[model samples]
Target: MNTTFGGKPHVLILGGGSVGLTTASELRKTLGTEVAITIVDPRPYMTYAPFLPEVGAGSIDPRNVLAPLRKILPGTKVVTGGVSAIRSADNTVVVTTEDGAQLEIAYDYLVVGLGAVPRLLPIPGLAENAIGFKQVEEAITVRDKILANLAEAASTKDPKVRKRLLTFTYIGGGFAGGEAVTEAEDMVRDALRYYPDLHASDIRFVLIDAAPFVFPELTEDQRAYVLNQLRERGIEVKLETFLNSAENGVIKTSDGDEFETDLLVWNAGVKPNPILMDEESSDLPVVTERGPLMGKLDTLADLRVNGAEGPIDNVFAGGDCAAVPDLASGEGKFCPPNAQHATRQGKRIADNVARSVQGRPLVDYYHKNLGVMATLGMYKGVGRLMLGDKEIDVRGLPAWAMARAYHVYAMPTLGRKAAVLAGWASNLVSRRDIIGIPQSADPRAAFELAANSGPKKK
Candidate 1:
C-alpha cells in the first residue's frame, strides 16, 4: 500500500516458504511494477529444506540455506509475522507483526501458501524432548547439540554419563528423516576419530521408524543397500517400531526396549499449518478431509481457488499448502509436498493470478512427475532420475552429485547458490569444527532466580 502503484490491485501472499516466494518471484515478472504484492510469514526468511541434512552435518554453512524474503523481493512488501486470521469475506488479514503489533491488511487477492509443520503425535514427553528437522535454526541447533554432547562426554570420565550424553535417537525414515539421521551420524562418527577418549562404538546412533524400509521412493534393492550400509557402519536401525514415550533422555519404544539418550530427532511427518487446518475453529476454507494444505492449492486446472462448481474469483493457493491434484499420479492423488512440484506450481500460480486479474484466458498446470532423490551424506546417496524414457537409479558418488546438482540448480537466487557451492567446496578441504554451544534448558533461569532473591538468604 505504501509503494506507488497508481491504484493497481494488491496481492497478499501468506507464508514465505518455497511456494510463497516462488509466487512472488513469478508475479514480479508477470505483473511488473504495476501490482502491489505483500508476503507474510512468521520468520523473515525461507529455509531451503533439502540442504538441512548438510547443515546438520556441518558440511554447508547454515546462513547459506536461508533466503531472506525482503532481500529476494526488492520492491514487494514483506510482513514479518504470523497470520492470526484470514478475513476472506472482507478481503482483510489479521497479522501479528514481528514486534507483536497487530495490523489489518486489505488485499484484492489472497494466496494461501502457508507450508506444513511437523506432524506430531500425542506420545508422552515427545513434545518436550524431541526436536525436528524442519527449519534452518533447528538443523544448526542439532549440529551444535551433537558436538556439545561429544564435548560433554569427553569432559567426563563416568561411563554412564558419557553413554547417555553420546546416545542419539532419530524417529522417522522418510527422506528428511533418513537424510538428517545419516548425515548427522556421519559427522558425529568422524568427530569421534579426533577424540582420544571416545570410540565410534561409544556413540550410539539409533534410527527408529514405523516403516520396514527407508526411502519410500527408492526401489526395494536400493532401500536394502541403504539398510546394509547403515548397519555396516554400526548404526542401529529399528523398523516397524512405535515410540511410546521420551523424557529426560529416556526413550521407551513399543518394541520392548528402553534407551537413555541426550538427543532425539523426530521427523515422523508434517501436517499443514495448525491454525489454518483447524476446520472446527478456523475461517480459512480448508477441506476437512484434505488436512492442512500440505503445500498444494485447492485450485482448478488453472490454479484458481476451486468452488463447488468452478473457479472462485480473487482467491488462489499454491505450494505445500494446497491439495493440488497430481496429474502425474493419474489416480486422483494430490501432489506430494515436495520442492519439484511446489516450484512448478509457483510459476503457474503467478501466471494464472495475473491472467485472472487481467480478464485473460487462464492457463492450466500439468507437470510430469520428476523422480525423487535423497542424500545420505557426503559422497553417499540414492536417487531415481527420470530423463525422457530412461529411468536411472543412481548410487554413491553419482547420486550425491546428481542430488547436489539438482538442488543447487533449483536453489533460488544466485547468491544462495554461490554460498552453498563455496561452503561445499570449502568442506572438501577444511576441517569440521567441533565446537558446540550449549542451549539452556531453562530459558529464564536467571530471571526466575533473580525475582526469588531478596538480598541474601539467612
Candidate 2:
C-alpha cells in the first residue's frame, strides 16, 4: 500500500449495487483523506430492490426508489461503465463503457462487489416468454405490461383472448416471488374499478414452485397461514410443480396442468454474474459445481479466496457473489444469498480490507440466521423471527409492517426514502397511474428527424 498522503493509494470498486455503495461509505470513513476511491458500475444509480415490487404494482414511481451514485459518493470519482475483467496479477481492471469503448484502470487495491444477476432457468420458450425481476426497468416494464393486458382483456370480445390476457403465472416461492404476487394482486384488485367488464374473479393469479412449501424460511404454522390466506383469496398455490414451458401466452406446468397466460414472471433464483466465472482470473477460488464452495474446502475462515494464501493481497470479494462461510451452521455451509447476508458481507469485507491495508489480523465471517418475512397482498402475510432460543411467529399486520419497515431502511438515501413514503401515503386514497412508456432503441431519432423536416424561416 502507498503510504504517502500527497500520492494517496487508489482504491477501485467494481459494481454499484447495495454492497458496493456500503463498502465505499465504510472505506471512506476509515481511509479519510488518505486514499482516493473510484467506483465503476453500468447504472448511474443504485436501486433499492425491495421496492421493485411496489414499482411493478404501480404503488410508487420507479424513480423514487433509485438513488444516484454520483450524488452519494461525492468525494469519490464515479465512472459510469461495466468492468469487463479483473486482472488481480497486475492490480488492474478493464472496463467497457456504455458506448462499447474499453479502458484499463490501475488500482492499489480492488473491491469486487459485482452483485448477482437474475438466474434464467432452462425452460422451453422461457427466454422469450418470462420476465425476470432484478432491475428498476424490469419493474417498470411489468407495471406497463399488466395494465395493458387488463385493458386488452376488457375490450376484447373473444373468450379465449380474454382468458389468456387475464391469466398471470409467477415461478418461485422466495421473497421476490411472494412479494411480487401480493403487490400485483393488490394492483389488479384496485384496477377492477376502471374495467367495467373485468371482475376480480376473472383475473387468475398462480404461484408455482418446485419446493413443497411457499416461503421456505417460515415455520410450519406460519407457512400454513400464508397458504390459507392465498387460498381464501382464490389465488392458486401450486407446490412441487415447476414451469415446464411458457411459449408466448401458453404455459404448461410439470404436473401436466396447462394454461394460456399473458404474464410469466421467473423469480426462481439468482446466480453470480457469469462474467466472473471465466478463466481469465486464476486468482478466484475454485467454486463447486453447485456454485457453493469459495475454495477447495467450503469453510475457509477469514473470507479469503483459497489456493493463494494471504488475503489475495490486492483483490477482495463478498456479498452474494462469493461463498462466505456461515459459522451459525456447524456444517461446512455458505451464507444464504439474501439482502441480510449481502448487507452484512459488505461491512465485514470493508473492515477486512481496511485491516489488510494496516497489516492486522483478519476476522472470519460469522452470523446466525434471523429467520424471514413475507407479504401476501394488502393486510395478509406470514413470518418467523429468531431471537436467541425463542422463535416467534407473526402474520397479518405484523408481517406487513415488518416487510415495509425493513425495506424503508434498506432503501438507499434520505431523498428516496421520503419519496417512497409520500407514494405510500398517496396510494391509499388514489388509483394507480398505469400509463405505458414504450421504449425505443433510438429514443432521440424521431426528434432528430422532425427537426430536419420542419419548415424553417431563413
Candidate of highest lDDT: 1
lDDT of 1 by residue, 208-259 (tens): 9998887777889999999998888788999999999997779999899998
**In model 2, how large is the Cα lDDT of residue 401?**
84
> 259, model 1: CA deviation in Å?
1.0
Candidate 1 ranges with C-alpha deviation above 4 Å: 1-5, 279-282, 290-297, 439-458
> TM-score of each candidate?
0.92, 0.91
lDDT value, candidate 2, whole model = 0.78
Go through the candidates in order and give the clash count of each.
11, 0
Instruction: Compute the lDDT of residue 233 as modeled in candidate 2.
Output: 75
lDDT of 2 at 451: 86
